[model samples]
Target: MNEGNTALTWHVDLSDQKLPRLLLRLAIPSVIGLSINALQQALNAIFVGSLGAQAIAAVSMTMPIIILLGAIGEGIGVGTASFISRHLGAGDEAEASRGASTALALAAPAGLIMTVALLAILRWVFIALGASPTILPIAIDYATILLPGSTLMLLTIVSGFIVRAEGSTRFSMWTMLIAFILNAALDPIFIFLLGLGVRGAALATMLSQIAAISFYTGYFIKRTGTVLVSISQVSLRVDLIRQLALIGAPATTTSILAALAGMFLYGATARFGDDFIAAVGIAVRILTIGALPITGFCIGSQAVLGFGWGARDFARVVKVAKLMVSITVSLSVVYSAAVVAFARPLVKLFSDSDNVTEIAVLSCIVFHLFFGFYGIQSFVTTMLQSLGRARLSAVVSFARQGYLFIPAVLLFPGISGFSGVLASQAVAELGAGMIALFVMLRQFAELRQGARDP
Candidate 1:
């Protein structure tokens, strides 16, 4: 068979695979990739933790801003993935290529603009993010290297999503693995041997991201994938951009809201002391690491659901969603139990301070009590995006971190003190999970009806 036929066969084979096997095939690599990424973050924290509480706090302060920068790329990536997968499912490779190309073309400028704009106001931004005076300089040192290199990060993220949408998840996994391994190796060398401290950690991350984007560049350049993204195919077509934006806006808003919520949480925690800030930081990192499997599965399922929806195979979509929800919720429960069971030991891994350890332990247990709620929220959000229900997705996204979380974080701490701060996320997750369940049930009904209709 010709190469064209081979490509078509590959795409068709993805849709033909058994549901359980297909999801596992896709999700396992993503889980491994994301887990490694999370492990790297944990390692970064440990490396910085040795610098003292102030160093940890400084690095933590940079997180919100870094997340804000990441939001752009993630939004674009999600938009590109959804657009490409659906088009490919419909057997329009040209459209898929065009959409992918347009997204890639847009990523660089977006990253560049953010880098310049953010660097200009770095100090003020950190101050607004509640960085204490002592932590401000270290935060600046870290972000300076990171912000400028974010363009590479954007390219790497968008490219990974593009390949994953094409069911080339192993390639996506390799990219992440390469970056993580490199970052892990460099962390000690840069941070300690080189005495760069927080700045060294930032440098390692930037270099690793650079390597990742290089791999992506070579993959696309070699045209090793079915969707060939090239500058020649790039288009500034208004409709395509609008379509991307429609899907992307909600994802971007979701991330931006999380960043804003982080800022608010940091500010509230700061009122207690730098130790509290450090404790919250460690708890956040641990929770993030723990959530990787659920998130990885949700991400993997996106390609499957998008393809099914595009093919008008409502049964497949429904089955995938059901299976995804079951697995993710179960994983959340197990992870939450494990974390609660060993919260103190986990907290001690990052710090030796009795005060920091105690606060982090409490934060871990409180933050994860309703984590199964997060599983529900995450899957539902991914389901909506995959099905092209942009408006609904946007609403659900805002409800969690925006409407619900912002209020809880703002008011709860005042009502209950530090304990209230710890409780805010759990409360928000519960509320959001209920909202997500309602929406998801409605979705299931619609999908079932669609399946029966013609």
Candidate 2:
């Protein structure tokens, strides 16, 4: 590693071999890193579950709002990743740094605004999400403490994107290493030993995010890299922000819709009690775990395709996108079976209460009925984003998270309550996956022909 070129280091030699081999090289590490994150969050939820149902329910309600704001981080980081990856592919280092600088400049304000608005919305956010009065106090306390720190989280995310796009996965991985370990270690101590209750949980999370901030910030400043997006590089201009947001906004908003949809699901299932809510929360975390492979492949393809698009390597982009969809869908069969086979033990990992366990186990199977299809959807949407096919990707994004999922949540609960709510997610995924598959196939064909899409 060249000490002076830390930022430029990611602009490495990409092998021109078979696409599957290349995708695997990227996907394996991404899977490990994403799994590590999932494990960290699961640990917190597991430990908190031991404290009782309200504690679990409190965390559950707080998650939607936290994740809602987390959209900025995902969106901005992705923008950075998209721009930097392409710049690297084009063999342009200086522009990549400027994009990196601009990303941070933009991320800072988004984080700041989220911090303040969440402060005022803390009480109402939960209430709006159908949180009952009994649990509202604890939920508010947790959200209030953790919400303000969303800014640091956004910075940390974009920083990782910049570094990773520069072909510095090791550095990006190491940063997560430090933050995840710190967060995991402090979680048990703060929640149990310090007896901080919900506040303890928030404190642990806050400290971890702040540490991530320091680790990433120090990496750029102290690293001998030319990624110095200085005061001059920072901009609040409409063009830069617009470009970044165009790519990121859809991904971010997709996550926001998921959070918002959770609220509707909550309303539908509330009659069953907090146990159901807590069970659903646990189910989500577990489901997300299984989807990691799909997520990783999507991200990996984004890099490959985004770069290909930037360089007018249309053939490579087409091959990569088609291969990614095929490989991901094939892998999903294995993932779904594994989950269904071990659903019982997986549910027990989160809660011992028979009622919670029962609901969780059942929810796990039902929620993932169309599990394989999620891979198809992830592959298509990520490919579109990487290729800067924003219009197509945005459609993929909105169909699954906003249009299909949200409406299902509202309509299903009215007809069938718990069953309806659970079924709605599977329906949305199934619908989106089918549509994305058709569109992705069509796009790949168009790319190969060097013809404009109709």
Candidate 3:
């Protein structure tokens, strides 16, 4: 079949299917893929853990930069996916293909710029973030190695998102799984056999990204769907770029804010000691793992929502959003309970130090208390983006991670010290989730009323 027909065929289920069933089809594979990817992170931490607390702390210090880069890729991905799905829904295959191509075009130069900027500021950045002399050198070394691989990283991230947009969720899922597995296999060899230490971890991650990029490049070459990632097709269309920026800038800012939030938390914890920083790092990784299912569900659901909105099937959009909320809430409950039950063991998995283990355990349990309601915000942000309500979605997204969380991290600790830090996240989540609930409900109401009108 032609690419346009292929795109339409892929979307048939999205428009005609039941919401719960569709979500299941999308979420199950995505969750599995994301879960494995989370596992790769945890294992990377584990590999670094064998070196020492300082190594762990060093990696922790650099996480904001790492996440910041990821944020850029994810933002672009969200923008690209939104545009592609919406265009595809409107039966505009050529435009959808062009958007995907433009995203890839944008990734290379952005990655190059990020690589240079990060390299120049590595030492200065980490130092400002409160890295001690002991951790500074290691942080620099690890970050220097990782920064050069930014292009591969961006390619992998954007490609995966675009593939998911094409209703090739399975392809996206397996791509991540393959990369996760590849990273896992390489970690030991590079870290131990070659004695690269923290640098090895960076190399393994970079190599894994290259593997993912290769898979995606192959996907485009075969032309299995409407979305084509081709250099020749990448046009400098000001309108498409503007649309993408409108939708993507907020998403990017949200991630950037998250990076800043990490810096804020890391800086705040610095007052206590490296043990605290290391503990927080471990706790954050665990939280990422815990949050993966919801993340995957939101990702999968966003594509579906975008398709519905593009088709002007507002009823389906609202129905799917409602079903997603129900599902996310259920997942949150399960995840929160698991964290509570496994808090000690999970923290223990990372460290044997009494101070580090105790602090990590407390933080994990305390930070996750409001996690059961986090899906409210995730659903709202993704739903807004899908519906092309970028500004509102951006506001909601900002509130969840940066606006609320940043201030909370900075101010809360003064009230209770470390315990304050732990509690701050839950407080932010409570507030953000409430706001998201309000926004989502109001939007649905408006959409419903509009549908009812003649």
Q: What are the per-model numbers of colliding residue pairs?
A: 0, 2, 0
Rate residue 182 of model 1 by lDDT. 98
Model 2: weakest 10-residue lDDT segment is 7-16
Task: Give the poorly placed runs of model 2, Cα more than 4 Å off.
Answer: 1-12, 15-21, 223-228, 451-454
In model 1, how large is the Cα lDDT of residue 272? 91
TM-score per candidate: 0.97, 0.93, 0.96
Q: How well does candidate 1 match the true structure in TM-score terms?
A: 0.97
Look at candidate 1 and tell me the lDDT of residue 117: 95
Backbone clash tally for model 1?
A: 0
Cand. 2 TM to true fold: 0.93
Ranking by lDDT: 1, 3, 2
Regions more than 4 Å wrong, model 1: 1-12
| Candidate that beats the other on TM-score, 2 or 3, i.e. the better one | 3
Q: Least accurate stretch of 10 residues (summed lDDT) in model 1?
A: 4-13
Candidate 3 vs. true structure, TM-score: 0.96
**Residue by residue across 227-297, what tens digits does model 2's lDDT show?**
55565777666876788888887888888887787777776667778888888888888887778757866
In the range 262-333, model 3's lDDT, one tens digit per residue, is: 999899898899899999999899888878878889888877889888888887887888888998889888
Best candidate, TM-score:
1
Decreasing TM-score order of the candidates: 1, 3, 2
Which 10-residue window in model 3 sums to the lowest lDDT?
7-16
